[model samples]
Target: MFRDEKGFRPTQQIFTEVPPKYDILNRILTLNLDEGWRRKASATILEENPSRVLDLCCGTADLTMHLARSAKQSAELYGLDFSHTMLARAKEKVALFGEDRVKLIQGDAGNMPFEDEFFDAVGISFGFRNLTFENPDARLHISEVFRVLKPGGRFVVLETSQPNNRLIRAGYHFYQKYITAPIGGLLSGNRPAYDYLAHSAINYYSIPEISEVLLEAGFSKVSGQPYLLGATAIVTAIK
Candidate 1:
């Protein structure tokens, strides 16, 4: 497995240790807006009528399920995440859906296990920020997405973004630093992990910077739309 500078191994332990409360904490922290964001991201792909879609860094496959349900066409969805525990949960979710349309795979985002031009669309939600730090080569995950998408395919990335509204931004910062960590600690017993999530969101690229990276990855027309008072942004690019 690839190791970041911090020696994080993308292990199953991270998810297994926090699996029971992961979705609950997510809903509480986002006030249930997370589902709406996932729906919006899925809608973008569905509007394009893709037949085969790839969900990169698909923790627990929630967004993958959303895409499967939302698509107008009969779609085959593949979800990839490095964590086995997360994949297990994803498989459980797929079983509940009772459809063989969704498949989950254990794979790294930077180096996927698929041939080039194999997918009609690729989507990621709240996961790109964990790719790496310091070395921009770690950002090759975007390039890999590009390589796997067929010509004219679409890519959607939904991630947390710094709010532009002053008051909202201040409130978000406070909540992330104080409220989120404590609540996550109480629920998941992993204050440090939640703290890392907050810190990573704080340090991640801005909308324009992320757009530039998508452009660098050979996406033709990259655009970003802010959501929930700019607390998150959805970026869409066409290959």
Candidate 2:
């Protein structure tokens, strides 16, 4: 693995230990809404008819597969992640799309392998938080996304968000703390990881806040679509 000052190795290790159960745990934690969210993100990306699309922080290629299933046959797709284990599982799952159709790579998000302006679109699902929340290299990660995307390209993010409704927010946080975290930890055998995930999901930014972050990173335009009463959102930014 490459050396990273942004605390990448530890995050890599956490996902490394959980990839086998990662997909299932995600479905359970979100009550099976994760699939729908990724599907929505896929549609949003394909709607633009981008020729080259990359799934940033792809993580087991769930979103990549979704993109492949929906994208035009001529579209080129790639999935990138830092965890060798996660990418291994992703490789197995994405192989059905054929190697010529979907490529998988392992690298740090803060320093990707692709050249600048290499992709027409980039989509990340449920993995954007790890690149931003309390991360010192957050700006670097986001800027890398901007660097790899073409000037008119789109960046779509499907991630957990803080709800505006006080009641819904409270219940969401409570469920994450008392139910999802413990169950996810138990099933995945990675309590520390699930603990961090729960904490981050509970404290992640609102849709507007994320839009601001993207704008600050030099995106031309940003918009969002909320789901589950704002507990989750799909934010799209134009490069």
State which candidate has the highest TM-score.
Answer: 2
Judge candidate 1 at residue 173 and give its lDDT: 82
The residue-level lDDT of candidate 2 at 190 comes to 65
Query: What is the C-alpha lDDT profile of model 2 across 16-42, one tens digit per residue?
Result: 765567788788888999899999999
Instruction: Give all candidates' CA lDDT scores.
Output: 0.81, 0.88
Mark the regions of model 1 whose C-alpha exceeds 4 Å error after superposition: 1-13, 132-137
lDDT of each residue in 42-126, candidate 1, tens digit only: 9987677888899998898889889877775467789999888888888988786675778889987878999999999999898
Candidate 2: lDDT of 111?
A: 98
lDDT of 1 at 38: 96
Q: Residue 160 lDDT in model 1?
A: 88
Give the TM-score (vs. native) of candidate 1: 0.90
Stretches > 4 Å off in candidate 2: 1-10
Q: What would the TM-scores of all predictions be?
A: 0.90, 0.94
